[model samples]
Target: MDYGIVSLRSNGMFAFLPLGQRVISKLVALIDEEMRSISAQKLSLPLLTSGHLWKITGRWDTTGQELIKVQDRHNKDYVLSPTHEESVTNLVSEVYPLSHRQLPLRLYQTTSKFRDEMKPRFGLLRCKEFLMKDLYTFDDSEEAAVVTYNEICNAYDRVFQRIGVPYLKVAGDCGNIGGNFSHEYHYQAAIGEDTLLLCNACGISTNSQLVANPDDVSCTKCGNQLTKVTGIEVGHTFLLGTKYSESLDAHYQNEKGKPELLQMGCYGLGVSRIMAAVVEVLSQDEYITWPWILAPFKVCLITPKKGSKEEGAKPWVDHLAEYISCMQGFQNDVIVDDRDKLTIGKRVTEAKKTGYPLIIVVGKRACETVPLFEVIDSRSNKVQVLSHKLLLNYLKEVSIEQ
Candidate 1:
């Protein structure tokens, strides 16, 4: 982060540098694609909400002291919304009121949320403000609600897998969210705050908070002994049933033309938390190597030593970098280290610290003869040489594989 990927502001908040923002954009794109495939509509909700909405659902007091409330010039109450359930539910009721045809509606928003954490730590893990992707689902019946829930679970699984993190879907507690059931997606890490128990034989996992005897529990499916591991929660899904709808008076007309409470579910992914969790789990020692899809740049091309023979090919290196930047997937993402008078070792070290997936070094031999590029895989520390003519093909294949 010394390269300005993320700049620390205080105990719980930070600013995303250009590189950091690019990674977040890529992650959001992937998630947006998945959510749109499942017919979820994206919308933005206000960051500040009226206290009346919170009071309607009794969340004004039940939401705890972490909630930030403010008074206006007229002494009217407002809240820096920690969640958007009341606002969205009320909005949807006004937009599409009491229609059986619009029963199973899915709406989501990707925005910053706030909570006055008493003790915020671990950067984005526990923050007073963070980006969150919260999705709300409305269904007419329990069966339809389950279908929507499973669809969201599958989408969340794809998201984690594509991000190349080893995450587990474990049984989770509903807690104050007021849901019938919940599931959490956890990324295993030694520095994580949450403890989870896993069964190797049956692949069963559960959060320690939800288990009665987490230390001595056996897998109910395979009778295997459980192992405890620390994990960071990156995503959570709740089968809320009618918890929010009934409390907020969000009712719809059914096939019988009778008013019934919508079966509700909420899914949340900690967008900024995922960024920090990726660093926590994937960082080797102090170096950070991100997956291709989540990396700010997939390739970094470096020129040779300024005084060396390889410096003859500096123009060609610059040309190749520009050409690569115009390609479909890597547009404007090829970082060409063209700093003059820098040694090859120093340039490579600086580039390595920024965590590009692949690095290509144009050295003396390649510049003098066959014009090959020495490619280095940052994550694996593997090296390979490829000719200029084959660089695009190699990138295409790598992109397809990732």
Candidate 2:
């Protein structure tokens, strides 16, 4: 009964509202599913690390003024990790001691990251406290690193696709983390903060930072100048060969008993940022529509007017609620809006705002006489009348199509 705005920072600390929690939970589950599909094992890392680790990697000096540094009770300097490559590498060195047999180790984690942003804005898009899904891969050779990097890139592609936002892969610059090659996954949106260039003829697309607009070549399709536009970067992967390994002395004993530095690659998906990107890219004038696979709730069931306002609705409301409950019990995702006070129109509007895939409206006429309900598909603007018995099957078929 109480709805209040939640502030992320009272004076400069992390806080969240119920809606924020729901969005984060959905994104984490979506990301974890993608990671598991690729056999990337999930691991948790400490939020704080000794400054010595950054010093060894030389990032302590080069990471600029953004690093959040603190001192322990013993006066030992520590850093709130903006990233976990060094930490993950150190942990692996202590445990796995890389061998060619364990060449491609894919590990990932979803956790809160800290950066002393000079100006954090745009709600969760740019925040001092943010959530990220960072993954690291270890390989025995540069060739192996490239292959694994591509595999992870494909996994990222699938992740965005399943999330229902159309994105393009663009060549990217390897900024602080030195690497040979990198690519960024960007979602095209009018309000995006990054720029992208595309060649319609050659099918080449890249972020403006890493792409050169070729004056020598024109669009092969129409012989027109290729257009350059901006997009929001949602994810990126880099092929890092022995950079972190050499920096951290992460060496492994070869078969001949010789020690060699392990090759490495790092992939990052801004989980929370992608959630905002989804909202920006997928929202329309009426409401937001998420891809069925990534929608927080697969279906929302709403009951129409019944009995008196205070006494609650008719018996069919309970029957329909029970039916949806049973359907969800059979592995379907459904949210029942059983609130008796809210009107049917208001509930439908709220359902659209929440980006549920399917909306089912149940009324006395449809419930008692035909046992059929009206279904609204927000994505395609299609409406259908289907019997209660066929609802689950219909949802399954439409979900697969999505």
Candidate 3:
């Protein structure tokens, strides 16, 4: 199974291979659409920023050694932004300019972020350069911030659910951002790196850093000792309040014309990391079973075991193409594997390895009969033969649910 020029060596830094790029792109589109539905205006921010911005927020010295630093020809210092909190706050302050009318502003960005990692591994999960979707909200008061925070929280939940991943919301430490409340969305997996605490009886869950019992001795639910487990942190939301605003002097004029710090919140979802999490959670044995909504290719048409020129393989190829063309009319992207060299068994194996949701087998009989195809569900070993006319109808029904 050679990928030719598309093959990637097992290196730590180069996280995404050819197939990974397709997976990541689909996930980004899914997440972006969800964010847009909630009125989250997407903005692109710079990958590098001046050292002064970091100094203003005290991150220049305290963010540890992961900060990737550089200098211009004139020796001006710059740092690759790990997160866009300060940059976003500075932009908001400059644009809105202390007007109470502009309060409750929500802005988000999806782009590449950088951090010089001491050790980068596990494909895109812990890469130094990766895609991230970060969001920031500005509010007039703590109450308003809470409201917006909860809305964003629900939005995150919906995003993950739509992508067919079960996520756990757990309390988290405020860390350097200095926030009163922080929650991390963890995808439960055995290979996850972060530990979480949960009370099975009461359905209470929290990250180990923030877990606490009333008596500090037993679980609050069934009076049993809490169990600790490891999970992957896929997303997080924090109530930053005036932390970044005050650090960057982002004050707005209140009703009395007095300068007041704006309350702020930050939410982050690792777009590339989510790709890794998907593989970690969904892959079984030799291949991956991507959720139909997040699969890079919805249908992979394979004409394995090509017939001789006299046997008339052209009709099967044309039939498959025509079917896919009709699907494209409905705005669905389908991949047709028309290579005449590959064997039927090889094509089937490759199609499954690529994690396509639906596989359509085209043969000579398929071109002559009204029911010329068999549909294979990649997740389960289930196959059904149906009429070509019924194929589109069934796909529509399943795709809608997906």
Measured against the true structure, the TM-scores of the candidates, in listed sequence, are 0.93, 0.87, 0.90
* TM-score (C-alpha) between model 1 and the true structure: 0.93
For candidate 3, give the lDDT: 0.77
Clash pairs, model 3 backbone: 98-252, 305-344, 366-372
lDDT of each: 0.86, 0.74, 0.77
- Candidate 2 TM-score, true structure as reference: 0.87
Ranking by lDDT: 1, 3, 2
Clashes of each: 0, 0, 3
Name the candidate that leads on TM-score: 1
Candidate 3 segments exceeding 4 Å error: 1-11, 15-19, 176-180, 211-217, 220-222, 304-313, 324-330, 367-371
Measured by lDDT, the strongest candidate is 1
State the RMSD for candidate 1: 2.1
